[model samples]
Target: MAPDQTNSADVLIAPAPGPGALRHRLEEAILGDIASGRLAPGTALPPSRTLADALGISRWVVTEAYGHLVGKGVLEARTGSATRVAAVAPVAVPDGAARRVAPAPRLERAPDRATHDLAPGVPDLRHVPRDAWLRAAREALAGATNQDLGAQPPAGHPAARAAVATHLRRSRIVSGPDDAVVLTRGAADGMSRIAAALATAGHTHLLVEDPSWAALRDAAAAAGLTPVPVPVDDAGISPGRLRAEAARTGARAALLTPAHQFPLGAALPDERRAALLDWAREVDGLLIEDDYDAEFRYDRRPVPALQGLDPDRVLLLGSTSKTLAPAFGIGWMVVPQRWRAPVLDVSVRRGPAPGPATLDQLTLARFVGDGAYARYLRAARARYARRRAALLTALERELPGARIGGIAAGMHVTVDLAGVRVGPAGAGGDDAAVVDGRDGVDAAAADFAALDAAAVVREGAARDVALVDLRRYQAAPSARSTVLVVGYGNLADARLPAAIRGLRAAVEAASAEAAGAGAGAARAGPTGAAAGSVG
Candidate 1:
């Protein structure tokens, strides 16, 4: 409280007890008196010194309480005037007495949340640097002028664009901050803009990786372009296959997550990266590089963005979604000089553009500029590395025979079933029994190898493990059998073992069913063998 401030009444009475400090209690008591009409409107509160004397409390406490009441309009104080209650007083809503209304009928229901969340594409949210973000926000707020609160450009904040450009230069080696980078909501938002820009540039067909991120495919379709699926292997998007697909479909635009392929987690090798850029140049095509989580590479040196090699043909898209948090919704697009005007024009006029508030952009700029972003990345990278190690260890010990790839980086690793087929149910006891080494079955042996991925997913879900079918990521099925994409980010290090165990049980059940069917067929003899020999 300020030195000049004081309560006015000659005598004061304390009220019933409540939570918080003495000052808060006094404020609540005074408000209660006014609410109950014990202290009427225009009733003067006691002088701070006098009230402190009467109540055996500090004068400063009384002074502070009165000041708080004055600020709330519960009490009015002015220079050389008595502090009195306002014409009206606020009534506290009693607990458990708030009016209840019937909940509206559900329209669209949310899916059941999994206990062990192994779903892909999400990072470990537990390690978000809240303190650093808050500090950056405060700094941005302190430095901001009145103009910063005003209407922002459709391309986003100038400072933010510059910050992002600086970041890309250091990380991806992309060009200037000047009219090169456009702010967006995230990678999805950037892709949507790129899709529209491609359409505007008269490109009808876009080449996309088989087993690509679903959002990229959806964005292309939403922009009225045909997404031709080009197969991706362990080397990332296959150069030969992508070229063939582009040639066959006459696709002039290709969207790729080259640094770290989604779901599969393959970092596009340098040779393939060069091939992609060459194909783009030869076809006069556009490459939209979604560099979502490139910073989280656990093994090998960082692969710079493909856009850095051919900025004219490649459009780089990046976001805080994977790095900082998805809720931030701040992203950027590094576009070719020729495409900038059209992209900006579409961004301003068309929909799904940058919705991140001006303040957030400023905060993000401050965060990146002050090196808080880099520090946060370093911390997150280490944490994820440990988690990934734990996941790999558990998978090796429990699942054994599963061929895991995409483990060198990213949050998920692809667990390939290595040509194992799900046998029919009649010949087996249960897949779990087989996988547990019951009935003289070796879990790593050939019989346990070819279990149904779909059944594993279903059984895993039943066992409280959220399993995503790897085929969902595939554009078309290849020779590899029953690949399961296990996302280790969401699951805690402790829960990983249990989740893997549940998954093992599911696979085992599948194997047992296959074995049971095989045994039943064998018992049915030469007739059964003749019947099974089809085509």
Candidate 2:
């Protein structure tokens, strides 16, 4: 097929979440961009790496964010060309399983007290300025304008669009000020809108990271876009693999986290990023950039965005959710010049932002307009940086001799049990003391995976940093082995020290048992299959 006639679904792409369960915050971000013209309908988007860098986040975060918008019909994906903002309303999502929220698991009563809630992906609510939020809300209500009282455009408030544009330019480096902003409630809304728009253009299967964000993969599946899991390494996804996958799946785009990959914390290398972009160009697919948690760099310098490398080929996405708080739910997209119309059309279909919330827009505008956004980011970077240090310190104190990974930037990091040799379940080469009398097998894997492995982790005798195994990040058919992802964002300062200690204790116990088991295993054979597996 000629490149122009290439089917959007021909190159494989990601999807979005259920339209109903998505919060208005996502709509606010996606529609806001469409309204402000940051992503013109029919315009191309930057690769996910570009968007991630520009916004200081992992590409997966941006991918999910974009998926939310796509499901809502705000953006369109054209085959072999680019993902574009739609000028029309996206097709309504049928009410389905994806729309329903899952009931929270019943709380398991007190286990060991470990305050490091670094189970990966949980945002740090510690820094949320509740008072500031309340103040902004009250002020908005008190100063309600006529616009605030009435039903508004689905594209959100004009003021919000402007504010977002400014924010994008200031923080995310989104070009096309007048044509570069849209308001969505959060990243999810943005993804839905984008998915819906893409579906309109007949886009289908999406390519996501092998060990990608689960919510995003779910989001795309809900959006009716088939999801294809792509493998990723420390340097991020293999560009060559993406090309082959896209070609095989006939997908319209590839959803990626280039800046800092989700669980592995793999930053997409420049050559790999360029290769991905070239692949998209090759197959007529676009790249959905998910910029998640790029603000808090604990070690090395921050990486540049892939969008800056090639703006037109990538969909640049950003949000205030991570930099601020999740509920703040604000993000924007910078689109190419092609699909602007379809994007606008999708906006109109979502039905005006409820109440137009003029004041919020005003305040947001003022915040970014006054350069507070940058300052806030700087502060957040510093704060998270320190938290990383504290967490690291605590880990050293608690789970000494642990293998820490992905600590260079972002709110989350990885914990590889390969070194510490001790874990909660005694799977990590534990000693003889903590044996459960079950033939002295290392119990770390069984222990960690036993207690509803999906749940948060706890340390034992020989513990580790608070973390959820890397399998949580698996979006592919293949299940990855053991690796823990610990997030510092949600962990409180006061609780961090103790959490580390608890982690240490857990690992100690687990390690003891693991050591006992290892002796058992070594006495037996080499088939004890262990970590280093990517989900």
lDDT string, candidate 1, 115-164, tens digits: 57787777665456666788989999999999888887888888988888
**TM-score of the candidate numbered 2?**
0.66
The Cα local distance difference test for each model comes to 0.73, 0.61
Best by TM-score: 1
Cα miss at 215, model 2 (Å)?
A: 1.4
Superposed by TM-score, candidate 1 places the C-alpha of residue 157 at a distance from the truth, in angstroms, of: 0.4
User: Which 10 residues in a row give candidate 2 its minimum summed lDDT?
Assistant: 7-16
lDDT of 2 by residue, 1-535 (tens): 1223333222212222324423343344445444544434564555555444333445676566666767767666556745556667453432331232222333563343233466665555545554455565666566668856677655556666776666555555556645555566666666766776777888889888888887667766777888888888778899778777877989868788888898788888788987888887777667878887765565665666676666767776667677777666666666655655666677778765622255666567656655666776777788778778888876665554556777478888787644443345323344423222232343443332222122225343124345566776775333334356777777666556666666555555444544545555554444544343333
Q: Which candidate leads the pack in lDDT?
A: 1
Worst 10 residues of 1 by lDDT: 94-103
Error of 2 at 399 (Å): 2.9
Estimate the overall C-alpha local distance difference test score of candidate 1: 0.73
